[model samples]
Target chain A: MLNKHPALLKKTLSAFAVLIFWIAVWYAAAAIVGYELILPSPLNVIISFGGLIRGGEIFAAVGASLLRVMIGYIAGVAAGVITALLTDRSAVLRQILAPMLTVIKSTPVASFIMLAWMFVGNEKLPILVSFMMVLPIIWQNTEAGLSAMDKELSEVAEIYELKFAKKLRIFIIPSLLSFVIPALITSMGLAWKAGIAAEVISHCKNSIGNGIYESKTYLETPELFAWTAIVIVLSLIIEWLLKLLGRRLMKFERI
Target chain B: MNEYNIKAQNITKRFGSEIVIDNFTCDFMPDTLYSINGASGRGKTTLLRILAGLDRNFSGILDIRGKCSVMFQEHRLFPSLSAVDNILELSFEKKDPALTDMTMSTLSSLGFSPEDMKKYPDELSGGMKQRISFARALLFKSDILILDEPFKELDENLRSVISDIILGESKHRTVIVSTHEIPEIFKNSAINIQL
Candidate 1:
């Protein structure tokens, strides 16, 4: 088994070595600074993380943040796919939605959060912000996937007279997944980050963003680092899950 | 029922300023084999595409009586599917055991091992992919079979074997094949249309 996956093993070991190197540098830097408020060591952050976990507030914060981000991510992905199909089929719709999506893509997330705060409550602002951040990315990637479809395979479908549902199952969905999966994995990190940022700005209750904000306001540098570590770990886990899902879907196509 | 399976009249195809096929006329009957012989860029693929209803940009009078199954010049197998699944996806009786058996037998005849049937298109060689494409066209239930350069990637022995299979399958349908030159086996039986 080790021989079969030597490359994957090597990659993991390399990543671990790089992480160790960075942590060592950070430890040295913290020692040189000689002040915990300025730069907390890795051990200081771990102790702070343990305190939060023991207080049971971290669970609630993590759960609330995850729920907000998941709601926005699911809705954004669904809307993106539907709109891409509509624009791909109709030139008029494409013309109408193109400029609007372009503007959304170019606009700053912070500005959108500030604007959304006016219309939405503190808890809901994060959902809207994450949705806005994810929509254009999924849309652009899905559109590119549709445009890059093999024309020859479409001609084969035409010649074979495949039914609409069959064509979608055998050709369209499989082809689109190649592009859509990467977009989904990429957008997941963006959605999580944007959702947390909106929470921090809006002062959403019972969220990791709230925890981070409180830590920063209280001058608890170690706690701030702990919250940031949680964010990074969650993003990596979500991306890894998305990749596994993509692999399973592609495996279904092969069968 | 129409006497002619396909009747194309005064078909003129042009790409921008260059003319490919100009005022070409042909009448194809059912249960006959036709070899469309031409050099590269002589519009054999274009004319076949037109007849198969894949290209509608040409000015022509075309009437096709039945469904068409095409083997494209390139092996257009789905990259995600195994060799057997690629052919099975196009079968009308996909759930039937006989269909699966027939697919396996056809693949076996075309030089595919049991292991080869489970391998995806990317894992297969160029000649193997071409044979899978040919198997798909042969197995699909259609009255008209349009094959564009079907034997272009095969060895001489495989070509002769594939030619025999094509001839054997042409007893009930109209088979139109495009090639640089007519194979020796098809020279006596196939109507050669030179462009």
Candidate 2:
């Protein structure tokens, strides 16, 4: 029942209205500043966006960065879910992983990026950084989901003599997905931000971070703004797609 | 003579410090629709759990029981799955040879139409969800049926629907139903056990 989509045209119109309001504020700020270099106006950024799109390099950069983030995201989700499952089964295993999870959660992303750059080098730096950023979130959410399982349900399975595989398929996975789906979608945005940051620091070729670096180095403020806008839009789009995927996976519940 | 017997010998259970079931003993005979009737918190559910081998920490023994399937006090339907899917899941796990027909027949006997099967627990009324939970318990392969407050939150008509199903199904099986009230329909057929 909750799966019903909101009114599409209404949502779109409201989104545009907000965008326009923000653009007006940005234009005013840019005018007061009296320099494109300090804060590019909305029009300058739009023009820069047009110029960047025409070059065709933006596509390659987006593609390269997206691929890296995706790889890292998948790795994180798999590792997190599996680890959570194992730890949930045994208190000993949970005790062992507790400190490690804490460290992963508390440490800064920049530090991880620098460490990853040293170890995995330029090409794999974003992938590692994104992986680090995503791992604890997915793990914690999966743990939450698994731990929230109804003990009564497990007793039901026991009396019914449900096999391990059947219990996992019927009750465990669905319960886990309910918790993990939101975390998965949230981690996508986190992954993109961390991945792009790593790319910028590592100066990877043919990546969004490299594009940002080039734009800023040559004093192309509008181009930098354009790249930032692209990052924001892509993150939103990817998050929406993941939500659709979540709905499909939970189609039985109608979301 | 009883066709089969489950002898409960001095069964006792305690929750923390309070003794809910204190050294109770009884024999559960087969081919009978039995109701454990008591007021709330009289350990009726607790005794059923013990009899169903769900509460093994009890002091006494409930011997000579075939496989037991239980309907819990709560609905316990998977909120994520539709009514049909919830029933079919356990049936599939049991590897029932005639899965579709078995599911359809059992649900139909419980007064569920084909269309109602596709709706999830949230979509169904409380009574309908209770009926679905009842169907899930009934579908499992077991000779001994244990129902804990099975008629809860249901209308008299729905209760009659369930009563009729139990009356028909319990003729050849040992059915233990726990409830606060034994419905008018079951008075003639059901053996009342006060807990």
Question: How far does residue A230 in candidate 1 sit from its true spot (Å)?
Answer: 1.3
Which window of 10 residues has the lowest lDDT sum in candidate 2 chain A? Answer: A1-10
Off by over 4 Å in 1: A1-38, A243-255, B155-157
Clashing pairs in 1: none
lDDT of 2 by residue, A201-252 (tens): 9999999999999999999999999999999999989999999999999875
Q: What TM-score fits each model?
A: 0.89, 0.86
Evaluated with TM-score, which candidate comes out highest?
1
lDDT of 2 by residue, B1-195 (tens): 564657888988988899999988877777788888999989998898888887888787778658888888887877777898888876456545588788888888777899998888888987788887788888777788888888899777777888888887788678999989878877878888887
lDDT of 1 by residue, B1-195 (tens): 338888999999999999999998998998889999999989999999999988889897998888889998888998877899888887563447888899999999888999999999988999999999999999999889888898888998889889998898788899999999789998999999998
- List, in order, the clash count of every candidate structure: 0, 0
RMSD of each: 3.1, 3.9
Q: Which docking category, incorrect, acceptable, medium or high, applies to candidate 1?
A: acceptable
